[model samples]
Target: MAYDSAHGFSCDCGQTEWQVSKTAKGSQVVCYCTDCQAHLRHLDRVDLLHDGGTYIYQTTPDAVTLIKGHENLALQRLGPNGMMRYYTSCCKTPVANTLSKATLPFVGLPLKGEDPRLGPVICHAHTDKGTSGRKQTGFAAAGWGILIRAARAILSGRRASPFFTDAGEPVIHPTVLTREERRIASLRR
Candidate 1:
């Protein structure tokens, strides 16, 4: 069941290009968290969600490669302590999300243009806040698998992500949301 280590992703306007891992190696998930909802709302595309959930494929930062249009990639945050949401500045297409701490090895890529061979959903996360009222099947098994694999990737010295420099700085500093903007985004949380 080996899969290709590389897969391509891009924005609607083709201003950005990304190389991410395939689903066999990456953790495929459906997230129903408030943060995900707020992220889509911030981009004015709440419609990205299917039943209030977004399909995401998790991989180490090192697994993502910015192939082109690096300058077009931008970052945004919901608040001072929110996940860093990356997008295309040209078309505002949501790209990926990462923890503010560069030491963390995980980044979640939106599965909008993924290949069908990536297979079906593995698990559901944040179901309590899921707006669609649907349950994720095999959550425990899939969640544990992801957790274990992520830990291995982190420990194996693969944290030098494409989104950050070797010195552990974001390629582009994120735009922190103001108090008013945070308040608005938090209303849905």
Candidate 2:
């Protein structure tokens, strides 16, 4: 379960865990690129960065681990024949879960259930490899919103961009989607 401090979390089994600071106050975005899709296949999850990846990107490797039941780890590559797609053996969770602490530190292990902790994914990579017409999604969707909010945030004389603000923090209250998302969803329906 997630900790209040926003720095660490322990799983129900106590075997898997991860941690990251949730002090930052920005909206988290989702990605659906080939890499992400491939990762989904490898992880055997339909929700990669969407429903997942909230805790995975925040925790330190030391804070995350599988205390037991490790015989279920699995690995495979999805994109090209040369690429490697790593995942769990039984559940096929994200490959991000099983990486060595030595090489990957910034990445986190995705949890089974929880509101993902991510902000408008400001950037994306490898757009050229998109299988569908959709590429470079979140940045555009959230760019205007982010810029508008960031501008109002800390206009402290053009320093580096800040990812948090008291004004634009996560809302515990329920809110409706914008006209755009509603329109799209309605059309799809």
Candidate 3:
């Protein structure tokens, strides 16, 4: 039941596995962003939002390694300009969330496969961005310690992310969407 791993995590269906850095290398947080809710809604997994929050561990993209079922990784966006969300294509299980452009070296690691060792939520984010009209708590201290940690990572040059190569290109090619397709997907009821 130990979630403290320098190894990483696996999907529910065992179709995908991603290696993560040490638990100390990432930030654990809960998010209530509208986009997050919408993504869950699109996947018909609103039930995973306990207290209207999605628990995730934020880490550098370089810390992740797709150890198995690379083809099972699928991508989605809330809009033409939204962040690229990656999931298991086989079972449609979300694995990570990242920016469309690879400039940012961060990824939100979902806590689906983690043991109870993930510890307390560091902070809540975008609590004011929920679109479901269901008021959720834990917004008073959003983005609390993230800024400092991110700055440290950036300044310290710890951003040699595994998501990209030395040439600054994505390791995996996501299913890019046109504006029209993005519109339809985002507007899904």
Candidate 4:
């Protein structure tokens, strides 16, 4: 599915194999917060978010898949930890979430590879724009966007945080990371 290399790789379904590449388009979405870094760290993605907070992207969502043994999909709530997070048991592909009242499998990585045209909406999470320290331009914009979104969301009775939404409504509760998870995250630092 990726537009890069084609080295054979294993799929959940043993019968069918997939292709992988060494080079692909890359992105770094600055998170500017610790939770953002922790999420990636929990997934051994610390290196990907090195600049304080940025989700590095390489393979398009469409390029990644669970063509076989999709039944092995297992969801874990790492945010609430005991609450909701999504991963495929077979391959641990970040699938979606199911924590809030927004029904099961609430949120997860999009299968953007399927429809390249539709990209993820940009948002600034945990941003207030009052912290004046960093100088990265895009990071600043993301922070400003976060501030604007938060103001709009709060005023309009909408969810300000974009990551965890309950029933399409912004969750008002705070996210908790376990001590063990935090300790593990420290390793990435």
Best by TM-score: 1
Compared with the true structure, the alpha-carbon lDDT of candidate 2 equals 0.37
Q: Indicate the residue-level lDDT of 92 in model 4.
A: 36
Between candidates 2 and 4, the one scoring higher on lDDT is 4
**What does candidate 1's lDDT look like per residue over 37-108, in tens digits?**
777777777667766678887767767778888889889988888888899999888888988877757788
How far off is residue 147 in model 4, in Å? 17
TM-score of each: 0.84, 0.39, 0.74, 0.40
The residue-level lDDT of candidate 3 at 175 comes to 65
Runs of candidate 4 exceeding 4 Å displacement? 1-33, 47-68, 79-83, 103-116, 127-178
Give lDDT tens digits, candidate 4, residues 135-173.
Answer: 444555544543553454455554322224455532334
Return the lDDT, model 4, position 110. 23
Candidate 3 lDDT over residue span 21-43, tens digit each: 66446667778766776677677
How many angstroms is residue 132 displaced in model 1 relative to the true structure, after the best TM-score fit? Answer: 2.4
Error of 1 at 168 (Å): 1.3
lDDT of 1 at 189: 27
